[model samples]
Target: MEEYKIRIVKTIQYIDSHIDADLSLEKVSEVSAYSPFHFHRIFKLVTGETLQSYIIRKKIEKSALHLAVHKNMEIKDIYWDLGFSNHSVFCKTFKKYYGLAPTEFRRSAPEKFHKILQIQSKNGQVDTVFSQYICNIENLLNWTKMNLKIEVKEMPEMNLASVMSLGIANVEPSFNLLIDWAKKKSLFPRENVKMISVYHDSCKITPLDKVRIHACMLLDERLSKQEGEVFPETIDGGKYIVGSGEVTLDDFEQCWVSMFLWMNENNYSTRRTFPYEIYHTNFKEHPEGKMIVDFCIPVH
Candidate 1:
């Protein structure tokens, strides 16, 4: 079952990282190295949805994030890029997810996403409770102004040895696994070896229980190999909105909000890429349990 978890997590990560991969059931099952039936069973057991359903759910959630934040991205771009067969299917799916038409979602973005990317769930009960703090934390901009020297910088491309961790709750366990493995391979020649994480799905849009994050260790150089739980992958070098600060786990959400506010005020939009964070110092090792980190938002 643990092996099944690895296979499913790796397969999902592969699909997200590639972005252009064929999404047909046959291809996905093949990628998982399991028979179609077995793949479906395992994937559903791990993710709580069928593979196709999971894919569609992610696409729809991502689309909602776009519609909610980036007014410049056309609906057609969202629908087509996410692999919807036609406009009709796109509209139907959009309504099914948000209980409104795509245009309606955009027109009502303010009401839909209360503040920045805060989304109210269909029932308007659960998400409303989760997002209550957004309004309360209006001074995150002050936090940013005081604590972070924000900059737009070019990040270098990286080849990473990564461990896939499901559920955001087990972040420490995931990093522990990666660090223990890295010690065996002697990759940490210095105390400052970079520790990075790429969250495959946004927690605001996706359920916290189902979110997937890759716990990635930066290798000293470009090398590629597949070694059991560890796999090789490259992240793109691009312009990013970056800020480094001493933040506890509690400050992360606020920091992220401040960055988004900063981006919006400064006329930058998200570049349709996965964002990442660089841990300058490990929070677990710190006496005060604060992460000295640079949260990088990929942008044009």
Candidate 2:
């Protein structure tokens, strides 16, 4: 079971980095070191989607994100860049998923995409907490109310020894594995070692069960894979809008919501990359039991 988790995660990382390429089942299964037949079943069982469906969904989501963020990129260009051979087929598939045509969606701009929907859901209660891609805009209040720092700057690439956080309630098990690996590698007791969580999917976008979070530590030099569970993935270094704060669990949600607000207000759109949080003071060890964290969003 653990080996399945590790291999799937490595396959996921490979898919992320090579999103625009020809990602056939045979090629991707090679990354997981599983045969196509077994890989299909294991991936579907673990991730709740057929392998082909997963690839298609990721490609669709990638196109949707581009349409939402990079408005200047033409619709044809976006579809073609994502390997969609036929424009009409691409538009149909996109609308089937997002419920809007490419032009209509782009026109809705940053609004419908970031819109925090507040309506009576099928469950017959007001479900206003999570939106599609971002959280409720109301989550922006606490950041201003508490006056945290939000700034934009250039960030360098981070070389990480990482393991995936299985879920919200299951982070500690993975964190312990990473910490023990770091300790054995003498990565601890060092000034530059930083613990970070790189979010590969937004909470609002992916289910809590399937979202990928890399709980990693920065290393002085990226060592070879000495352990199967601990692998290396590099976080891209470029321009990012960051928010720094001493926060609780709820505050962490607001920090991300508010950071998106900051980006929109400042005329910055997100780059096609993941956001990350750099941890300074551990909440468990802090005097006030709060975490000192930097929330980073990559942008063009």
lDDT of each: 0.73, 0.73
Q: Compared with the true structure, what per-residue lDDT tens digits does model 1 show for residues 148-190?
A: 7789999988888888887898766877887787888888647
TM-score of 2: 0.53
- What is candidate 2's local distance difference test score? 0.73
lDDT of 2 at 262: 57
Q: What is the lDDT of residue 129 in candidate 2?
A: 22
lDDT of 2 by residue, 1-300 (tens): 134335666676677557789789899988877656445644554455677787778788778777887878988889888888898999899888889998888887574552333254664323442231022122334434474688889999888888887566556678788988778867775785688998876665467887778888887677576477889888889999988888876667556656765565566878899899998877887766798889999998
Q: Residue 113 lDDT in model 2?
A: 57
